[model samples]
Target: MTLSALDQLKNLTTVVADSSDLEAIRQFRPLDATTNPSLITAAAAQPENKALIEAAFEQARAENYENGELIERAIDILTVKFGVEILKLIEGRVSTEVDASLSYDTAATVAKAKELLHLYQSYGIAKERVLIKIASTWEGIQAARLLEIEGIHCNLTLLFGLHQAQACADAKVTLISPFVGRILDWYKKAENVSSYPIDKDPGVQSVKQIYNYYKQQGIHTQVMGASFRSIDQVLGLAGCDLLTIAPALLEQLEQDQREVTAALSVTAAQQASVIERPVQDEQSFKAEVEHDLMAAQLLQSGIDGFIKAREQLHALLRQSFGLDEEIKA
Candidate 1:
């Protein structure tokens, strides 16, 4: 039997596990790993991961002299704890996100990112071992740009459009995670499409466009395709710079024997070079993205989902803490 399609893809792109579960990460053995607050919050709620979360919280409570301080300390401790565990699993960097609440505030985004970096450092992990994940807002991009100069590599997340990719490349950031699956999800719900065409899939097209643009313009920033819906979407982006796939999809690819070809080629990207366009500024970026209906709608929708997930996590935390309060009383 020949190697599976997923096996072959590892040759063309760096495979990242888009998960927070330590054991799942261990299972996939992705080259890198990424996690957002929503994934982390979900992981923390799991019975198996509860011990891990509690250990961080207990560490926070021990260090804090007051309840207010305890809560703040707990968040930091938990974030670092997850990063540390993830670092042990993957050979490459682990992406730890900044607070989604500060996505629009450049200064606050920078501050929170630095704080996350410091927390990871306290665990004996070097700054290079971590990728600070931030929302791809204009403000967040600026924060990442500043951090990159200071040697903090960032993973620009929630990236739905080319405008975000161009801005990040211009900033000389480390990497951009363009969401192929999430992009498909939005279109699926809106258009009632059951499946996507390989060459024409919205998610695949988005990443291919961004990848070619970066290569053509000599942008050094790496593009990682993320949020995939199916194996076809993954195989469609076989030659992407990287792809962060969920464990389930990885397993599906491993089990299925299918033809995999280089859908994206350097030759194709070089062909796009002849018509290279300059990266956009703020006003033009907003305008250009607004012109693309999919990018505009999906970007707005993704931000909404992030905000909602954050709220749900907060409510869950409050309930957990309230239970703890009763236990303490």
Candidate 2:
């Protein structure tokens, strides 16, 4: 009896579902789950989740929040609402991202993360079961550094380069989501090529570099490869600490009965020659990110994209609550 590729991959890595759709999460049964603004927006727009959205709005309204504050509170509640449901199905942690608008503001980011944790606790969820996801800006990393001391776990996201990953490790972040497909997308457009061989894929190489470096440096921060475009990319990083794959790809892996191999190992990383870089200060961190065009562009665009998604969610909430209708009247 041959095992499915997903089952074999699970033996080598912790598989996490990257979606807010409860049915999909239930079906795939990923060990953990993650949600971002885009994912939440899409989930909130679905008719099946209408009650979740309305319930969050009512809760926010019951608290006497009005207008912008009401919508803002609802969005936070809605994000955690999805997370709480996701946690019920998965045994591991559920990553609930902070508002991307705070990506550049460390103080705001820290405050929002704490607020989200408090909301989770309101639903009887343990702090240990939640990872506050934040963008990987210099300020965001500093914010995670502060949160980690307070025992709030964080997942630094939108990471595209070594400097961002190094800074995250320095901060002792609980995890870092280095994007796989997004990196590949950037290179394909920049280099004017359609695709690279799976072995030579820039995205796969980026994750391999980060994973090996962390293993070599004895860093305890977990690496979760995210945003995969194909199952081949997922297979390429078989022994990653974790991989947050989309539901479509997860379904594909569940159906395929191919043999999977561990492409990374601690033993191999320990033997590899990796350079050690000093922890970055704010100035150096900014300079290094600026020096790398891909990282700089993608980091900003990812933030903007998330911010847009957040706004879209907010709009959906306002319409659902009839706030838009009241204003028109």
Candidate 3:
């Protein structure tokens, strides 16, 4: 059989599974994996993972954790637990996000990230093997900057525009995960257009622009195009430093035997010149997000959605703990 598209893409770009499903990841064998509060909650709801969820809640109870805070810690433990399971099937690192509620609080984000990393270390996983995922907000980028200084790598996520990517690269982040599908989603909805050519897709264009800019500036940070909605978006960015694809889309690539080709590269990027780099200071970051209502709305909604997902996971753990409690509002 001809090499599957997934296998061919691996030749030019590192394919990271954007899921918390161990079985799916085991089958694909992606070099690394990424998880968010939403993905983890989805995994916890699975019947096969019921025991796993209960076991984690029991451990939290034994530790004398009570009330909502108990579930909070359990959420952290569950995130690491999933990471540990993923690490078992892959040799590369895993990216676990910090609480979305802390997206604007640098200190809180830093502390929560440290707690998560400590949780992973307690499980015999090296800090080097984990990327503390954070929002691309200025505060989050600041937290990532400090984290990097301490040898803890980070993946700046939910990035939409060139300014966000510029900020992440300036922060010396390990990787930036720009949302390709999300960008395309915004344009398609905003313009009332149902379909766009792959080459003309906003999401693909955004990643390619960032990739070219990064290479032009000699920035060493890696670009991982993420949140893809279709195969064209994936194939469009074939030579990105990495692509964190969902398992369903990955399975599609596995089933299709199309020959994948590299479309972005450092050598090709050398011929590309960016118009002007965006200023990404605190004031500029806030201003940029405010000016681009699309970016502002999406970032806010993504944060709110992730926060809700974490709370839902907490409620699930509480149910398994023989208690039904509400959020401490």
User: For this target, which candidate reaches the highest TM-score against the unseen true structure?
Assistant: 2
Report the C-alpha lDDT of model 2 over 1-329, residue by residue, as the tens digit: 88999999999999999999899999999999999999999999899998898899899989998888889998999999999999999999999999999999999999999999999999999999999999999999999999999999999999998899999999999999999999999999999999999899999999999999999999999999999999999999999999999999999999999899999999988898876788678899999999999999999999999999998887777787667634310
Residue 58, candidate 3: Cα error in Å is 2.4
- The C-alpha local distance difference test score for the whole of candidate 3 amounts to 0.90
Error of 3 at 202 (Å): 0.4
Give the poorly placed runs of model 1, Cα more than 4 Å off. Answer: 65-69, 273-275, 323-329
**Hey, what RMSD does candidate 3 come out at?**
1.3
Question: lDDT per model, in order?
Answer: 0.82, 0.94, 0.90
Sorted on lDDT, highest at the top, how do the candidates line up? 2, 3, 1
Deviation from native of the Cα of residue 144 in model 1, angstroms: 0.7
Clashes of 2: 0
Write model 3 residue lDDT over 106-138, tens digit each, in one string: 999999999999988988999999999999898
Worst 10 residues of 3 by lDDT: 320-329
Root-mean-square deviation per candidate: 2.8, 1.7, 1.3
By descending TM-score, how would the candidates be arranged? 2, 3, 1
Model 1: lDDT equals 0.82
The lDDT leader among the candidates is 2
Model 3, residue 175: what's the lDDT?
96
